[model samples]
Target: MLTLIGGGRDRTGGRGQTAAAAIHALLREEILSLRRKPGEPIAEKDIAAAHGVSRTPVREALLRLADEGLVDIIAKSGTHVSRIPLADLPEAITIRRVLEQLAVRGAVASATGSQIIELRAILVRTAEAAEAGDTEAFHRADEAFHEAVATAGRHPGVWALVRHVKLQVDRFRRLTLPLEGRMARVVAEHEAVLAAIEARDAEAAAAAMGAHVDGLSLGLDDLKRFNPGYFLEDSARSDLKRA
Candidate 1:
């Protein structure tokens, strides 16, 4: 079932946005965060009732989500949360890795003391989240750490571009967070990148960033085995069944 975060209340009321936009944002978050699992049905009428709005806004929100590759709308069957595109993961990870390498290199050149401090603070928060087994908090802090680095490097647009291409990767990552030692490993990787940034070594920072991003592909077969339905099956990955 599509469960709203706050008892289906209209949390966006009076936020100076249209109901469609608000609902779109809410649904997008749920989809990305894995609260709404892939292939899960999304009923328009239920969403409208949850938000106290008509079906028009719900439909509008769903259309936007479909455009973002987060929703699948069928003419006769129904709408569903789109499954993660396994084939797209490799290219998306490559793009994000390249952009983040650029970001960290730029940060090494332009990052100020305070910006570095802010990055460290975010790292600390990530570590704390990992220690507490708070996957969601760790995810947010992980994003913040990368965004801060990009901003410090004066390449905020790089982060924006990365976000656009990494949607599927993000959803895949959420699935990986609960794996044993995964969160702690991420914190360690972040430390390595931050250490290079603090040392003003552009090359090292870029290398660390690449490695960190590349690690997202690790354990893919295991994930597919555990949650087969969450990923879109690909001919190239037929071995997943054997694994």
Candidate 2:
């Protein structure tokens, strides 16, 4: 079961609004991080009680989540964390590849010396988190590294668009985070992109970025083999065929 617990506010400051936002952020993180499994039931009553809020706030939060496709709110039935839409993976990957590769190319052309150093710092932190087996820390650093690159490239807006579709991909990535040496490989891949960018080689940087981002092919087989229950039925079969 998922629980929401945090700073409570007084009624005067639109307590319900604050509570709803708080619940929404907590639930969103849980869904994205796979702590709240896909298709898992999310009881408004339970969450309300856990957070000492009324069902009204919980409902508001859930509706907001539904807008983001993070949850599905059925009319009569209860709400559930949205399942990974495996069929959408290919399209999502394509979008991410194009936009992120462009972002890297832009970074190579426009990034400052200070920005390059900041990216290296993020990579170092990522490596340290991976070495320590801190999955959450590694994930945060990974996201930061990409965001830094996008910012360095002067394409922060593009990064926003990338994030819109990356949520689905992220759930899948979280599932594969436990594979042996996966984090280390991720670190290596980041290093490759950083190296190309640091050397001011736009072509190499784009190629490296493309390879790193599109390398989802290698993990598809493992995901189906190891965690078959996580994917949609038809999509799972399709993924297996591709694998």
Per-residue error (Å), model 1, residue 117: 0.8
In the order shown, what is each candidate's alpha-carbon RMSD? 5.1, 5.4
What overall lDDT goes with each candidate model? Answer: 0.88, 0.83
- Stretches > 4 Å off in candidate 2: 1-17, 234-243
Question: Where's the lowest-lDDT run of ten residues in candidate 2?
Answer: 234-243
TM-score of each: 0.91, 0.87
Off by over 4 Å in 1: 1-15, 235-243
Instruction: For residues 90-166, write the lDDT of model 2, one tens digit per residue.
Output: 88988999999999999999999999999999999999999999999999999999999999999999889998988
Evaluated at residue 84, the lDDT of candidate 2 is 74
lDDT of 1: 0.88
Error of 1 at 172 (Å): 0.3
TM-score of 2: 0.87
